[model samples]
Target chain A: MKQFLHSGFVRLAIVVVMAYVIVSLCGLREHVSILSGVDESGTMHLVFGLIYILSYAASLVLAPALFLAAIIETTLSKVNVLSRKGQEGRRLGCSELRERQRLRAPEHAP
Target chain B: MKSRLCISAIALILAIAIWLPLLHLFFRPDIGDLGLEKGVSRIADQLAAHHLQIWTNPDLRNRELAQMRQLNPEWDFMSRTFLVMALASIALRDESRIPQCLETIDLVIENTLLIEQEDGFQDFLLGYGYADNWKVQPPKSIFVDGEISLMIGARRMVADRADYQHLMAERIGNMVAQMTLSPVLSAESYPDECWVFCNTIALAAIRLGDVLDHSNHSEFLREWVETAKLHLVEPQSGLLISAYAVDGTPLPNGPGPEGTSIWMACHMLQVVDGAFAQDQYQRAKAQLGRSLLGFGYSREWPRAFAGVMDIDSGPIVPFVEASASASGLALLGAAGFSDKKYLRQLMTSLNIAGFPTRKNGTLCYQASNPVGDAVLLYALVQGPLWEKAK
Candidate 1:
């Protein structure tokens, strides 16, 4: 779980989601009317609006994408590890069979 | 670790590749069901509910109007006009809502007239509107006069109002007299500055007035169109210029063939001269309309005459040059002309970027203000009113 959290994709996804939640909770969505040239409050409002919109777009598109990518990466790596283990197990089984055949040959040599 | 990093990078790229292309699908509305032809669309209904609530609740309406008036007083006035027009269209579409729509329309008209009476016409104009003396005497803004006229005329179209008859006639008369003073037969929305947007709207109002009162303004309307074609059109694009002088010469430094003005101009012109309006719509569409990957938008100016952004254009998206205001009005133009494919694409873009919000059975776009939402509503429910006027 700690290693999973260490993944760059997962960390970025967490950041995006956290930022979006903070922006949403701050009620900055109302400031987004600035895009339509409706807000005249000040640069502060514009800044807030831009932040809110960026966070929103990130949350909607980027966060999901990052999470999906992380999940896929984890799944692929897991499959790789399992396949390697399977190959090692098969190799060990073959060596054991060879050793058993060697023992049987010695016994049949007489 | 390195392999995991590479896998993550590739996975990220692949995920983006899959997601970006599919994003619009989630926001894509079924265009056919939007009621572009007849009946009230679901979107229209929800948008109307929001506006209707605003009108009924004075506190809410005041807050919205105050927010708009801070940026541009014109938006406040235009919001009322667009809302009234939308309500009238909705009323026409759904017979059962006639009473509710008429009540709201009357409320809007009454409030507008009261403001105009108390504060004067400049109440609805920008601060620069007072900078230069109006060329016409008694200092009336056709921007104010024309839109108010259209609002009244639209209301009367749904059902006759004896009180508004004289009001409509007076507005039409003022507009006609003032417009005739210009070489292009246009009136100024600002001092010495005539807008195609305002004049076309006034012409539409006059046409509607003629239909309602049996007044004859056909010759004047025809002459205006001819003059516009001869003097007001941008040669490069063959679309109408956005602003000009009272003498009908296009302002050298002014906007040329702007989407913000042309789309609504085409719509208003539909009632005056169908062929000319159709030509303008096609030309405007060819010049200003743009779509990419199923998302549609409009540029404020054509490529040959890429103008600076202004209040009318709203914010222009860099490189692509998408004007928020123009795109909103383009919806009206596309829907009015029944350009289904463009309309669908535009709606897709709208649904994605407009950030539609719904609460208590009402819908409004978080990215839009009262005027923008009203414009969207008018776009959705535009056809029946225009058809009735015709």
Candidate 2:
């Protein structure tokens, strides 16, 4: 659903999973020499190396960042919701009390 | 969908930004962590054992050697030299291993000389080595002669072999006579190409020959050093030029560090002249050495010089100018001079970047071949040989 796709946590999870898949599929970690754009075969493995490096960076760096961002976003949104509920509750309570007081004022009036 | 994707992208970028700076923290190597000690390091023992295993077992040795020979036969020959030197140093360190080391030394020497005799000196050189006819009457490559002599001299330094003693004398005699005859006191390792690396190894071999035979070539070494100081130095970088013509003309790629070349030059120079060797190491350190996020490496050329990438330089990483060959060999220079800081940094880099693989009690870098591993082994155990020679 659009709702699920819009969820920040779900999006981050997708990215992390995608990166993990690509990283595993490419066998990037085993080819660390790709960082220098050269492999043991003495040819430029730059494209593969770039993919490996990027996937690695994403896995280590971006995944954690997305998790942190989702945590902060969820926490802040929850706090906002809770505070709004508390204010509404207080206002409703005050209005209800006023109504009772008004109704009782007539009873207790001279 | 677009908004969600944008959010995800932003989060990813921020995460990557945080991770990139701290990534090296996971790889930062302490000197202790690298197994570096006062004399021979633990990694040295492991690497030496791996090489010993290869040499002792023909199946493993042939497979490894065939891989290198497929690329360059010169690497196969050089691997023999480096392995012999490493084993000699290890023997000097541990008396119990002397017999085993000597056996391997004789085996390597026998095989190398056999190859040279059957295939000729051109067998030990790149095809370009014989690209043109030699200016000198009879073509003898200092590259083959020099490394072979050092191999022989190192063998004698550990324990005298009368056969190798004669071979060492003969090789040094030829080198000395060749230098004496040349106008600039330089001899060719190829047709007209002379490498400072081969010449330095020849000088070190001559010095070791003196230690063994009690015949001093002190004056000749002194004159050669003087000539090199005046002509062989790259004025801009103050490091010795890598290659030159027989007439002492600096080659087009002359002034570059050429990673594999400089480290060996620095190592061999230690025996030829300690003070000068230290000076070369320092200049090279200032120019080519780099440490980023605790990982140390060496550049193929100083920042001031624009150089080409060759087989010797290997592939150079763009921003840092880190050469695979140079960075690996930087260990030799760092260890040779007792430069603990750089040594530790370089070791950390090797672990982080060099793709170390150990299986069944033997170790080798997956990213490097047999020749690279042999050179690394020599760098690790190199000190003992120099100490004994001194």
Q: What is the interface RMSD of each candidate, in Å?
A: 1.9, 4.7
Local accuracy of candidate 1 as per-residue lDDT tens digits, B170-208? 989989999998888999999888999999999999999
* DockQ of all models, two decimals each: 0.49, 0.20
- Per-model TM against the reference: 0.88, 0.82
Best by lDDT: 1
Q: lDDT of candidate 2 vs native?
A: 0.79
- Give the range where candidate 1 chain A is weakest over 10 consecutive residues by summed lDDT: A32-41
Fnat values, candidates in order: 0.76, 0.19
Task: Estimate, for each residue in B305-328, the C-alpha lDDT of model 2 and write its tens digit.
Answer: 888887778778888889888887
Query: What lDDT is reached at residue B174 by model 2?
Result: 94
Residue B230 of candidate 2: its Cα lDDT? 88
In the predicted model 1, the residue pairs found to clash are none
Error of 2 at B212 (Å): 1.3
